[model samples]
Structures are given as structure tokens and as C-alpha cells.
Target: MNTQDAAIPSLDSDLADGAITPIDRPTLHSVVVSRLRDMIIEGVLLPGTRINEGQLGQQLGVSRTPLREALKVLAMEGLVELVPGRGAMVCVLTAKDVRDMLEVLSSLEHLAGTLTCQNASDAQIGAVRTLHDEMLAFYRSGDRLQYFKKNQQIHSALIVLAGNASLAMVHDILQSKMRRIRYLGDQNDDTWSGAVADHEEMIAALEARDGPRLSAALVDHLTRTWDRVKDAI
Candidate 1:
């Protein structure tokens, strides 16, 4: 067998060894997409790097079909570029791209803040506050990943509370592209502290049901977030 073929452990062997059980094709496809997405967001597939389909497929123990489909989904999410002749490359965001996305995201968060104030149930707001507190705990414990995950949950909860599916959809699309950059920003002590403080303001605004204050705070928070990452872009 070729080196590449030898390198790929058989799925059947995994099942025989009780390492993994059989799963439906759809489930397998979803797993492939998620794995690829995580790799991209974690910078395993570095920005502007050309995608090596053969190596990637072998490493993933997945066929080209599922890998290709995952690439298509990532392309739609603006994480990958499909070059006609050269195949796929990881998308690199320019400074202008970051600014443009942040601009639109700022507007979306502003609208979300307004709607969340007017429409969110007390329970929903409470949930966000709980998440915010949990995120703070993680931050204090120096668990950056868990803190960021909870931070994202707080933001998503606000979007869900906004009662607009279209708005949530657009925000999710833009947010995906910024995930890595935002994670990097969270590594900086000053920026991370500022972000935590911003969340405190957000929770306060929500508790008060102050739509205008929440809206303004979101815009300012997002603007400052961009400021933290702009130099890196």
C-alpha cells in the first residue's frame, strides 16, 4: 500500500476495536464539517494557506466527497475561497474586511439590543445575566476558552431574544468570520478586561430594559473590539 493509504486507519477497524460505532452518512458529514470548521477557527488551517485536499482527507480519515461538501459550507461562511483552477485557500481578512464586517455587526447588535430590551422575557434576560456571571468566573479563573464560549452564549442569547430570525442569521454569518480574531483579542489583558466590563454594562442595560442605552453600549463595545483587533488584521 502507498504511504498515504497506510496512514489512514480503517473506520471498520475502529468499529471492530470498539473505538467508534457506525453512524449515518448525514451524521458523518456533519462531523466532518464541524471538525474542519474547528480547525479553521483554531488556525490549524492557517489564513491564506492553500488547502491540500489529499493530505487533509487522509488526516481526517474522510473521503473527498465529504471534505468537498464541508469546504463548500465554509466557503459560504466566508472562511474559505474557492479558486477555479487552484482549488481552495483559507480566506484572509484584510483590515478593510474586518472594518466592514464590524460595521455591519455593530448595527446588528444595536438592533438586537433595542429589540431585546423591548421583547425579551424576564427569563431570557435572566439567562443572559447568568451566562455573563459564569463568563466572568471563567475569566477570573484564567480559563479563556470557557470564558469566550460563555461570552458567545451571552451574545447569542441576546440575538435570540431580539425576536428576528433574519437578524440572527446575518449576525451569525458575520460572527463566524470574526471568531478567531476575537479569540486573539481576548488573549490581550487590556482588551479582555475591556470586553468583560462591556458585558457588565450590557447586563445592566438589559436589567433596566433601557433600549437606547443598550443600543449605544453595543455600538461602542463593538467599535472598541474592532480597535483591539484592527492592528492585527
Candidate 2:
């Protein structure tokens, strides 16, 4: 071997036996998508408003390419409509639309609750507990955005813990589309407190591994969610 080649260390052992876990960091495109999702959910980008790509690109400090890509992602998530020549527009969900999706979601979550209570490992339940604690902290601090994010995470975790990939896939699609409407469900102090209380019951049921109780809690929560947001719609 050449002298320089001999001096260089081999990575064969490290490649085969490395113990370091890979970090899962969000990509720039995903970050942009998340910001746009938050804006829509919080009503900053009102429904039916045309997305000004250039303006948003500048505001977000990203070039048009990534911004457009992010918009395409949002379109797929049903949060935006892509018009032929008019660009993207924020999607408007009618009361019927919200009701229909929530009904379906309630059913899906009902199944998930029972399955999760039966199937989730202790560590999986602990992970959800951690998310719940963080969500409570955000609620206490009056950080609505962070609280909502954690709230969504907890629901997603429940579906995931059920161990049904097909159910999870369908649930995710509906959940993504309903995010903006769902965010409005707890807009006031009274409704917010009610929603938080509902979550407390859910967590208690989950920790106790009571499938029937968790299923009932999930259904009740989604049913009340309609009442909370229907007036706004």
C-alpha cells in the first residue's frame, strides 16, 4: 500500500458495529411545510385566500423552489387547492365536510383506542404519558400552538401503538385534513378546559389498560369536538 493509504484508518469495523443511533432531524422543506400548516391552522392564512408564493417565500426566508415544494405537500394534505393558473388556495372546510371527516375519524380512533389498550407495551404507554405531560405544560404556559402540536402527537401515538399500519395510514390522512378545523375546536377558555379534561380521562383510561373505557372516551371527545367547532363553521 502507498504510505498515505496505510496512514488512513479503515471504517469497516465502525460500519459493522457502530452503536450510535441516527438522528432524525426535520428537513428544511418539512420545516417550511410545518410553518405553513401552523399558519393555516391558526387562521393566519384564511381559507380561499390565494397563496402568494413569492411573498411567503420571502417571509419564510426560503427560495421559491422549496416554498413551492412545501405548497405541493400542503396540497396533498388537503389544506391547499392547486388551481390551474391561479396558483394554490387555502382550502375551506364546510360544516358538513368537517362533520363527515370527524365522524370517520371518531370511528377510527375508537378502534385504535381499544387496540392500543390491548397491544401497547409499557414503554409505549410511557411515551404517550410524556407527550401528555408536555402538552399540559404547554397549555399551562398558554402556548396554544405547541400545545396543539403535542395534542396531535398524542393522538397519532395512540393510533401507532395499535399496530395496524393500514388503520394508521387512513387515520393520518383524515387527521391531516382536519387539522385546521380541529384547531378551532378549543378556541375559547371554556372549550379549551373541556378539551383538556377529556384528554385527562383518555390518559387515565389508557394507563389503566381499560379498552372499553378508552374507546368510550375517544368517541365522546370527538363527538364534543363537533359541538365546540360547529358554531364557528
Candidate 3:
């Protein structure tokens, strides 16, 4: 063989026989969509990157049918853009989108906390307290992921305590949009400490059942969080 030809290695000889195993194919469209969504949120798929169906399907060990369905769901969530001839691309979030989402979420969360102060059940308050304790534990352990889950529980519990279906639905959707950003913020050392303190303060207000105080605190907390991320987002 020529020197150039000898320099190239063949794939079949790169490893022991059967060194690699194929991944399991996804059975449901939602599962496929969720896997892709996770990759996008976790930074595996960066913003504005084109998704090649054939290549992505091969990478994911999925067929075009399932990959297409997954792309459709991502498009609905504003995470993927559908181009007429180019297929899907990861969405690039703009400042405007961030601002609008912050406004909506802040208002709804503030209102939800206010209503919770007035109408929350004893059991609901207890549940929130439990979640608060869990968050404290997670924080102490430096497990930001667990802390994040507890944070969601606390927020969702407050919304449920509000007893407004429409408001809860709105808050839930807003939460979905901002979760990844919030998670990253919580992982930062300085941000995490301050965030823990804010949670404690909010819990105290909830325990006191003070609607106005809770409402104001909720608004301020959410606003500050968004402010921290404003420049980057």
C-alpha cells in the first residue's frame, strides 16, 4: 500500500469484535421528543444548530418517523424552528422572549402566592414546609439538582394552593420555559446562597399567611432572578 493509504485506519479493525453495542430504539414519540429536549436543554445541542434527520436518527438509533415527531414537539415548545427545506434547527432565544416570559411569570407567581396566603389549606402549608426542609437539605449537601426539584415542588404547591386552574396552568407553562436557566443559576455558588435565603424568607411569609407581604416578596424574588440572567439571556 502507498504511504498515504497505510496512514488511514479502517473502522472494522479499530476495536475488538462486538466492542460496541447498539442503543435501544425509543418506542414512543413523547419519549423521543423528551430525549431530544433534554439534549437541547443540557447544552448537548446548541442554539441555532441545524438538526440533520438522517444523522440525528443515526446518532439516536431512531428512525426518521420518530425523529420527525420529536422535532414537531420541540417546535411547539419554541426550542426548534421548522425551516421549509432545511428541517429543524435549535432555537435561539432572544432578549424579547426572556423579558416577556419574566413579566408573565412574575405576575402569575406573585398572584399565586398572594392567593395562597389567603386560601391555602393547613395540609398545603405543611407540604410546602416539608419541601422547604428538603430544599435546605439538598442545599447543604451541594446537590443542586435535588434542590431544584424541591424548588419546583414549593412553587407548584403554592400555585395549587391558589385554587385557580387557569392561573396554575399559566404558571406551569412559564415554569417550563425558565427551568433550565434557573437550574444553571442555582448551580452558581453566589447565586445559590442568596436563592436559599430567599426561599427561607418566602416560607416565613407563607407561614404567617400575609398576602401582601408574600405577593411582594414573590414578585421581587422572581424579578431579581431574571435580572441576574438578563445580560446572558
Candidate 3, residues 1-233: lDDT per residue as tens digits? Answer: 99999997765765555655667886678788878877876667877899989998999888999899889877876678899988899887677877788889888988887899989988889889999998999999988766887888888888989999999988877776666566656747888888888888899999999888888888887877876667556
lDDT of each candidate versus the true structure: 0.88, 0.93, 0.82
How much is the lDDT of residue 147 in candidate 1? 89
Per-residue lDDT tens digits for candidate 1, residues 122-222, read 88888888898899999999888778778888888888899999999999998878876777777678899999989899899999999999988889988
Question: What C-alpha root-mean-square deviation, in Å, does candidate 2 show against the real structure?
Answer: 3.9
Q: How well is each residue in 8-65 modelled by candidate 2, as lDDT tens digits? A: 6666755667744567999999999999999999999999999999998899899999
What value does the lDDT take at residue 190 in candidate 2? 95
Instruction: Locate the minimum summed-lDDT window of 10 residues in model 1.
Output: 21-30
Leading candidate by lDDT: 2
Best to worst by TM-score, what's the order?
A: 2, 1, 3
Q: Which candidate is the best by TM-score?
A: 2
**Model 1 regions more than 4 Å off:** 1-26
Clashing pairs in 2: none
User: What TM-score does structure 1 among the candidates reach?
Assistant: 0.80
